[model samples]
Target: MRTSSLTGVTPVLTGSYTPDSGGDGPGIAALRLDPTTGHLSYDEVEPLPVSGASFLAAHPSLAVVYSTNETEAGTVSAVTRADDGTLSPLGDPMSSGGANPCHLTVHPGGEWLLTANYGSDTAPGTVAVHRLGADGGLLEPTDLVVHQGSGPVAGRQEGSHAHQVLVDPAGRFVLATDLGADAVFTYRLDTRTGTLERVAVNPMRAGSGPRHLAFSPDGDLVFSADELSSTVTCHRYDAATGVLTALSSVPATTAEDVANQPGGIVASPCGRFVWVTNRGADTVAAFRLAGNTLEPLGEVPAGGAWPRGLALVDGHLLVANQHSGSLAVLRVLDDGSLAQPHPPISAPSVVCALAL
Candidate 1:
């Protein structure tokens, strides 16, 4: 698809990842989202020359956006958003020194930022911890840790791949999902020094491939999405020890068909429902939560293919469909199903969506 010159709105800033296909880096885009209509229109799009920018994480104060490059020479770029939504380079990008940095998290106090490096075909995956400057930039890496383990599935478990790293709502714990290891490694947050010391490590089922995790509003329960098994596991969280106990494993996918498995899992801000993406099935699964149990409420046809990332914004849910190259806006029904707000909006290789 040809790149479209963005027009028609005043964007507050442009965000882009480093990985663009065909030797072309992804475009840093300025966006204007209409709250009333749930419409997103682009204002500007500038090419980011950096390669492999996969995830863009905004700072706590919204002063900057950081991009992770899932490449051999792992790097993170700090970018400032202008009044017009055009991104300005902050300073020299820092090398993660690991490989394939997939996800990043900013400290609640805005003092530290962490990256989960997924590694590559030749490199073993690891986690890189860095401090954040007051001006919203990544401090040079002072600490890095490598993860090692293999899952039951030989094809998928050749080596460790750190899939995601998330901070608890209270900023007390940091969780990393190691796909190859089939484990969720937990750590205690040290804001003063920007370091991660192992608090606990919880193993998921043999071949579950724990991919990503999200916490409930109260921080009492944790939900992890298992990419390979197509299941979402619920765990009772121990805030003091950072230990997670299995409560129940819910099938995000339906039947034995691999097509029904989900890619992402997140709870509604109201804590009434949970959302997961069934990538191969091209649907978004919504479920109602009652204590520790979850009841399925049918699937929402994401209006696109391969729905990857979803965010609950205000009263609507925004979904980025990776294969259809589009973004969709949907409203949660009282019964927990999702309905389209309008036609699916277009974006090239859309992977994640974050509401500011």
Candidate 2:
């Protein structure tokens, strides 16, 4: 094991685009986080080479990271980070069993990795499961679950598009947000075998386009960011049976006239608030959370264009702006309001930010 101090600099791994890239950029870049000011600075290290590293997830207990190469022939790669914060490839990339794999997350037990494959024009969306080696290297996918059906919208929902896969806090179930299907699918995980068994398909309003979801700290509530309709939906979560009942749905953007696409949703650490990122409006909307309900707290400028990813680090809210090629740092005030601390930092086509 490598021993390192957490005093001066915190390592941050960012997935970005390359020069001649089509989908965003090319590789995964390294960054340093100032623990004091919550500011980020590029580390000037050579990024780990990948085709279209869009979304990233770190192993819970290892110095390894996984990323989805969002392309027609989707692949997931494993990279190990050295003690000095440099990254190197761990193994050859593995096919994600579908096209345009966009998001991935390591299981809470660190024994499996799950990916959401946003299918291409010719293929249907799927969710793939891969076993993890003892050291966190990704093994070949063990199972691929193809989603059927589509939403009400035309052109956008011609087929299923699974966007994200997340394991519930209790580890009893895995939930996937299908943007094209307009629903959240729940699965009972066979932990020992590293496979998934479909338990439920919770449907949302047609055309809601549920892209990403976040669960409350208590695991009693779940919130989804609806991409097509620019709405946020709160659901009552039943951890025992993995059922989600829609409680309320509200517009993600305060302004009615502005066209907005909601990208990411995250609940506060304390479970007092929920935050969602708006792409077209370039704002982050905050909501006060009550028992199975949400009251709009307001929205603030994202400090950059096209906020694609939002992560909570320490006590700060980090927004990865895809179009602006920067990451904005905002302080999470005590009352759950956001306050911009420093100007946005440079990061080209940043889609995911993982703090270590």
Candidate 3:
């Protein structure tokens, strides 16, 4: 087990894109988050020796962190965190059953680890459900639900590419966003049997290409960051029936001619605001909650280039500026707007931030 020099400061784990994934990065690293200033401390680890760990998720009630290897022969691995801030592999890596596994989430019950395999041209994107060990290790997969279909968009929409997989707040359904298919599929997980039952396939705009989704604080709605169209769409979620109905849509960034690809999205805990990161525009746009709809609250420079991932913690927003290889910090304002961004912290190909 390797440990970073984290003593007085609280640490936040970060995932990065490595050379294997066409990125120049140090794989996985540890950074610090200051509760008072809402700024990040420029402390990185002797980076964990993992490859293509482009995204990461922590177990809800455990000290284990999970990562998708995100390679041609996709794999998943688990690492346990020690009390002294050391992290060790829980077990040997296991095949993800498809290529380019991009996103994953631990079931609320903590019994399963789910992955969204964003397959390449030869492989179809699939959702794989793996049984979780008592210690949060990834075990054998119980199901691999492959997505099928294509959208009107060219190149990116040529095949089925599942980008993100998340379990609903209710813990009754698992929703996977397929950007290539322009659809969001809802599935009911049979915990005892370790299976996924396809419940609903909600279609987005013909070529919206939804990437990641965030639930409203109230859990009554889901906000999707549409990558191809650069729009944010609101969907009314029916928790009872596991159905999602598209309600409205708004441009992720009103900035004209930017050709932006909307990436990460986050909703305020108070339900007062929602923020979406625009890559090409290099901005983070805000939306004010007006009754059941959203009103544009303007945007702020993302503080770095290619802001691809975001995390909102304690009134502060952290943007993973992928192309620029840095992490930018933005303060969340009371009126649901963003203040000027703070200085960017260097981190090679930083793609995602997970609170530790």
Candidate 4:
């Protein structure tokens, strides 16, 4: 057990994962963090006992939580978080309508949740929308949209694959990435009715395979990770019309060799720097933002293999290395570099982290 360095407030962090045992037994884990010393201790690992859950989103206001089960018959689970960080299962899960629902988005107001279903060849892909009730549970399916397209990658882009879903800061639009289809679809969101209408569909580079997206604090630019090509694409975002125009693409891979490819991306709260993870390469790349352009700052060893997910909490960078089963901790310096890494703690196939 680690001693708590918390002074006035207790800090809790939540994580999600799929166990090696192959049953409807996916689980959510909770741990406590010492704010001053950055020490983390195991708190509770709740047994959700649901099938195929791979990602989770915590409500910003309510104590409710949402997770997606990626499968042919994908489902989203709703749960309630207690004051101590323990979770209780909420209402019955909702179907995603397509296959392999891997990513989810919660509206800024915490009133709606959306899922991106990366459908298989037979199933096709879909975006499932749901109403988040006052208590944080899902009310019902409000709308669902199917995707269609093919890209240069013969096998991977043979069909639509809705990779991620994210709502814009203004909460007026929802953006969905389709890796297989090589497109980012923007939809006008009806917050009151929980509906989405196709606003614009922007086609990416032939085989870029856009995976995940992050919006700048000012909501002027959007950054997306292109998994297959190992690049990060920038776009000028128009909040009023729900449109995105390509600005530039930054190469995530250096000359020597590329690692696990780019995955999650996050812009610093202050909007000074952007951080992206390279899984196979075991590294994290930092970029300095000048207006709308991205200048590579430097790359640092992530301290483990396959850093799939990352979180910036209290100025520290926490990396969730999925394959290595470790959490890499680093201090972000003023110049957008890393301090010497603190020893990482072993975690169970951590795919995502939510600081509470």
Candidate 5:
């Protein structure tokens, strides 16, 4: 694997998911990072007419970016990236086929885009797929797979709420995490047709509410961050067969309280450590791999409240704090511990950050 060199790393993009009812936040914020000093400076902000521009994904090999307009009537939009790291609207937004589309990912081959719709009163949670034109514009959805079933939890798990959809590293399978169902559903991706076919369902502990998942560098292991239970579960992944077998589940926070909610999870670039964010606890937990198992190293304060997303860029760990509406940059030490080089930078309703 090629490691990122920190010498020239500069621009970072952030996505805000503020609801129209509340805060005044620009949809996208541009930031410049000083690689030598690990300091961040705000550059500019772009206003997206859409109410909730929540999550953002970059094209695999293009100067394009895609964002999920997370609202009651969900939509997805694309933007063109300029040479100086500015973005311009690509075209009109496209329907996501369901309400409150929360997460989206670009296929590794760059031919397809997939979104996980967190359904509302009038719709059911579904996974939608759209074909990408050569210019990176999103076409109409080719397929929508609506999920059924619920978990044991009340209120939160009243119905299926698909939160995230990610294509496996090998591009052979797509995994969708259903927070309301407490399951990770696997699908066989038909790349030629931009469709999804369910192959397997890996159920988590009842009320676990699995949200986001990360695959190990070798693609043999998968880790899921359970939002409701504040635990991280390990699964053995068969890349060829598209099967996930649960191995173990561990708490993300050391606190005895059950109120901590986990948000995003990621594996270290070197695959030596796994990290997860705890919302109520306002901490990021570090766990080391021990032969398919995770051993907790410790947890550090996330520098603000509600760390929703995490990204590793230029030897730094960037965290998007939602409630606090700030971006925290921390130096990632060799031992996998985080050290703050500067105070958190301000950005309203910051939920997702992408390093470019």
Candidate 6:
């Protein structure tokens, strides 16, 4: 059964670091999206308590959602999502097995949860695995693997920083992006044991600082958002052997004299284009896909500052602006360019947007 709604209104959940955790917004918020005009507003002003809910992922087999507690002593929590889009705690939080966990994903089987702990400046990052119970609650820990490496970039690359983790579209491999190490790790997860086995360490440009990656619709190619160098790397993925081979790198924006850092990336559903968010440039850049080349289509103002994450809702692109504290809605034109449908709506310290 589905929750009744006002015509075509869509529900979206937002994750943020509360003022208690050095950010704006209260906590996890439920937002109403009017797709007809790309208008977004708060369904309610109040929030459900989940401290530092920096990132969120939905369960594949249940009405549950998981979030990373992005604190010094990292933790993960699960919540039961009502059909009306309200959220409630499902269970007590579980240790993430490392510090500052930033991203998480549910395995295709819906039996395991994986998290990437982006350790602080001195500590190395780690990837932790936890089993999932029948009712969608988190079970005991299975395995934790620590990453070790450093990139050419100073300060930001002094130690390993695992930025994002996800299962490949093929469901045969696990990929984690390490920003401090300038490498993307490939792993084979033991479904029965909930353990991870290292498969390959795909290296990127020395100082690129790979943060997140998105696979092409066909799953044959991948585009990585490099934070430190403000570039996107194209990789050819061999689904049969689970191998990732870097083909090329291109600037996230063509603008000059801008100190840009790209933090988010997504591929069009049609496999015809790729989009990346530039923080310093405060804009979203679109690129046309031709074989392995990423040709610059154009750039559009992000409608705020520090655009950190993006989510697609039908023909609209929703951008989370961390600093300016607003959600920018862009219409995806037929030619792959972006245009603002209307003024951005207010959303304080919004770091991640996940449309339900």
Identify the leading candidate in terms of TM-score.
6
Tens digits of lDDT, candidate 3, 1-356:
22335544457778888888778887778777775687787553367767888789888788899998989999998988776566678999899879999999999888899999999997988999999988888888999999998999989999999999998887889999999999999999999978999989998899999999999877899999999999998889999887889888888998886789999999999877899999999999999877667799999999899998899866789899998998988999889899888898998889998877
Q: Which candidate is the best by lDDT?
A: 6
Task: Identify the runs in model 3 with alpha carbons over 4 angstroms from their true place.
Answer: 1-9, 42-45
lDDT of 5 at 105: 95
lDDT of 6 by residue, 34-143 (tens): 88788888885457878888999988878888999988989999988776566789889999999999999999999999999999976789999999999999999999
Q: List the residue pairs that clash in candidate 6.
A: none
The better-scoring model by TM-score among 1 and 2 is 2
For model 6, the superposed segments whose C-alpha errors exceed 4 Å read 1-7
lDDT of 1 by residue, 139-170 (tens): 77767878888888777778888988888877
Query: Any runs in candidate 4 off by more than 4 Å, and if so which?
Result: 1-16, 20-26, 44-50
Clashes of each: 9, 4, 0, 4, 0, 0
Per-model TM-score versus the true fold:
0.90, 0.96, 0.96, 0.91, 0.94, 0.97
lDDT of 5 by residue, 185-222 (tens): 99988988888899998888899999999999889899
Q: How accurate is candidate 6 locally (lDDT)?
A: 0.89
What is the alpha-carbon lDDT of model 3 when measured against the actual structure?
A: 0.87
- Write down the lDDT that model 1 would get: 0.74
RMSD score of candidate 6 (Å):
1.5
Clashing pairs in 3: none
Q: What is the C-alpha lDDT of each candidate?
A: 0.74, 0.86, 0.87, 0.77, 0.84, 0.89
lDDT of 4: 0.77
